[model samples]
Target: MNQQHPSMEVMCHVHNCKFNENDYCFAPKLEVNPLQGSGASNSKEALCTTFQPR
Candidate 1:
C-alpha cells in the first residue's frame, strides 16, 4: 500500500511503538485525535488515535 503523505514527515519518539523508527512513524497513514471529553489542557490530552501494535 502507498503512504497517504509520503512527502510529509511525521516524527515519533515512542521507542516502544512498532511503527516508530528513529523518532518517526512508518505506517502508511497516521491519525491524531484528542482524547474524549473534549477539553484539552495540554498536549497530553491528545492521542495518536490510529496507532496499532505490531
Candidate 2:
C-alpha cells in the first residue's frame, strides 16, 4: 500500500513517546483530542492521543 507523509513537520516534546525523535513526532499518522469540552480553547487543553510509550 502507498503511504503518504504530511508536508508539515510535527514537533513533540514527549521523550517517552515512541514516535518522538529528537523532539519531533514521526508517527505515520497522529491523533489529537481535547481533554474536555467540545473543543480545546488552548494548547494546554489539547491532548495528544497518539502518544505511545517507547
Model number with the top TM-score: 2
Worst 10 residues of 2 by lDDT: 4-13
Clashing pairs in 2: none
Per residue, candidate 2 scores C-alpha lDDT tens digits across 1-54 of: 999766878999999999999999999888889999779999899999999999
Instruction: Name the top lDDT candidate.
Output: 2
lDDT, model 1, position 46: 89
> TM-scores of all models?
0.65, 0.80
RMSD (CA, Å), candidate 1 to true, equals 4.5
Return the lDDT, model 1, position 48. Answer: 90
Q: For residues 1-54, could you state the per-residue lDDT of candidate 1 as single tens digits?
A: 976634788898777778888888887778777797866778999899767665
lDDT value, residue 30 of candidate 2 = 87
The alpha-carbon lDDT assigned to residue 50 of candidate 2 equals: 97
Clashes of each: 1, 0
- Candidate 1 lDDT for residue 33: 77
Off by over 4 Å in 1: 1-6, 38-41
Measured by TM-score, how close is model 2 to the native structure? 0.80
